[model samples]
Target chain A: METNTKILACEYQYLESSELGQVLTWLEEYGEKAAVLAGGTDLLVKMKMGNLQPDCVIYIKKIAELDYIKDDADALRIGATTSLATIERNEVVKTYYSALYEAVRSMAAVSIRNMGTIGGNLGNASPAADTAPPLLVYDATLKLVSQQGERLVPLNEFFVGPSQSVLKPNEIIAEIIIPKLGPDSGSSFLKLGRVSADIAKINVAVYMLRSGSKCESCRIAFGSVAPTPIRVPQAEAMLNGKEINEELLGAAAQAGAAEIKPITDNRSTKAYRQKVSKVILQEALQAAWQRAGGAL
Target chain B: MERKWVKIKVNGKERQLYLKPNDLLLNVLRDELGLMGAKYGCGIGECGACTVLVNGRPMLSCLILAVTMDGQEITTVEGLGDYDQLHPLQQSFLDHGAIQCGFCTPGMLVTAKGLLDENPNPSEEEIRDYLRGNLCRCTGYTAIVKAVKEASKAV
Candidate 1:
């Protein structure tokens, strides 16, 4: 029997740093030559494919400070290296951030989730990343650290393009801060994939806040429909302050479909994505509205 | 790259080996330790043929650097059972005719062991969901699902 084994060709020094200062120093010294290894799910695969050949692979899993999920006064502070499984099993995340929970749960499968990290997910910056749309809907902020200092970047503005982010060579994502939802707010995430565990062809996340029978606020985000995960501000504007019903939802969905610029890929066609985006957005809106104590 | 010496527990046995920085756990288990049950179906993590248990959690051995896994407990399919003394899952797989070509069996068995250890009596849907990563081109999954269900009854 023939085996499909991968022999990583490049020779790189491996540095396992247990402290933030050590990581910063290594990053400062090596700069772009130093690649951070969080869970090794993305880095190792990229290395095997010869897409990335760095002089040094810095293993940051040993840094104890970068592996935690804490509930702050008004937000959840998640360490960048926290595993997807950890976030999926978090009670607070499951109860309050259902969109994130569903997105994390929908990522890959059990084994990959066990070995994949949220920091790596954001760092990889794939427009189709399952966690991006949900984070956009939650208004999540990412904290990046370097020898100079720390800075927070809004999740919406983090991704510049596919497999690209605004992160500098010296900076690393340290933490993710997600604000708590307001009262009577609910969120939902839906994705269309070739298989249950495959990468999403298109995904949508919706967060809605209800004030009596009218919509107080609504945020809609789509993934795999553009060069980056984008917020449908026009769609949100159409639904905000309007009494959310099937008619309003349909109109908003149409508006959202019109707003996104999807390209034809091997996984899906532009027409299929355009049609499915509206359907998914409608389903997500209905689910979020129902969760927010709305009848429909 | 410098070769580092590390100690890891494999199948309840401690092993110390000199490994390169890029040596994956999959190669160490197959070449160095001579445990070849875990097949390398996909070098990348898209396929679960390299699945193994690290500290009781299922992970792709191909993606894990052996140097970083020092002092961790590792469980491969060889630890489950042999032909003479079959584990309940192995026995169930045999009884339910879940083995076909047998390329993905080791990974499936190990992943199922991880699932059954966490949830002794899992529903059919839960079993299917947990085993979604382990792909078997044969068996069509009906018998595989039945074997897991049968193993759950005995476990």
Candidate 2:
């Protein structure tokens, strides 16, 4: 029954957990040797490329409690194993979290979205992850669970570096909580890729809250321009409580671009990213502003 | 690693097979079941040459672990039809000359079948968007899109 195809190497046990308790028990027993498989979109790719070879892969897609999208009193709670396609098709997500919806829609393709999960996107912690910028602008929080207990970490602090996160070996990302946007608040996500299906070269997400003719609050985030998805607090401070206009948006865009640290990579040059960051931020801001009931 | 017995429904028939934890669905389909219609262009999911229907949804078999797909319904190109009686999409592809190198035709046809299953009548733009995962270097997509459009009417 054996063929000459290059199969995944390394001895491993595939365990499917139907309950959170069973996953925790398995994690506690196997800990460092176990890799959690949610969608297997990224994990399998990495394993095929010989980049990762875990001794055990714990599949959590069977955990019923871990695949849900519920609207709580204050925010939307998305289970870690919930597929991107579910979020893209959900009426609530489409209406309330359009930035997330757009980002999810713009990800790989229809089939990948059907199999890839929001948790897998965040868990991979790629600087160019399409969901991170939108999640950051949404002020999302990640709930991490372990055998000991659960802890919630703000999305901004969850990432430490490229392909790294604060997640402990025995802990799993249980849910992502995205706060509901207040009235007169609008958000948008924009990504510049080499092709329609390629990964983003430079992406930006903007969230704006307007009051009358003034900007009450603003949050700007960029991807592929830093080690992790980051918010431009300096840019936010400049736009807060200020009258938003084309000239002001230009200034904010420059400030935001100057604040990011981008490195030249295979996808794009650092200079190109630094330049496009401003353009995409301005574009996102204008779109968000129009959505927030602002003119021009 | 110990081999585990997994039961799955391929096309319409129920099947039980012993598989390793890391065995891919693509390998199991082609090697074990002799379903050679699904090609192996890219071992990764980037290319849709290994596309198949998992629970009536288009998915890359290259990325799916066979053990994790237990009890799921799978459909490959071989399940569609034979030379005597071809599926409507297959007929349209042949009529429209959409098969060039033919390496990517199976993936394209399977993915198009999934799209038409979900959306009986799709606009040209919708067909392009849905089949963006399936890459065909031969036909430049014009004839394939036309074939899907023609098959939509027939189906």
Worst 10 residues of 2 chain A by lDDT: A1-10
Clash total of candidate 1: 0
Which DockQ value does candidate 1 get? 0.77
lDDT of each: 0.92, 0.90
- For each candidate, the DockQ is 0.77, 0.67
**How much of the true contact map at the interface does candidate 1 reproduce, as a fraction?**
0.73
lDDT of 1 at A215: 89
Candidate 1 lDDT score at position B43: 88
Evaluate model 2 with DockQ and give the value.
0.67
Task: Give the top-scoring candidate (lDDT).
Answer: 1
**Candidate 2's residue-wise lDDT over A1-296, tens digit each?**
33322466556888996899999999999998899998888998787776777889999998889999999889999999999988998999898777898899889888898899999999999999999999999999999999999999999999999999999899999999999898898899999998888899988999999998788999988988999999999999999999989999989999999999999999999999998889889999999998898887
Report the C-alpha lDDT of model 1 over A27-102, residue by residue, as the tens digit.
Answer: 9999999999989988988888778889999999889999999999889999999999999989999998989999
Interface RMSD of 2: 1.7
Return the lDDT, model 1, position A5. 44
Residue runs of model 2 more than 4 Å from their true location after superposition:
A1-6
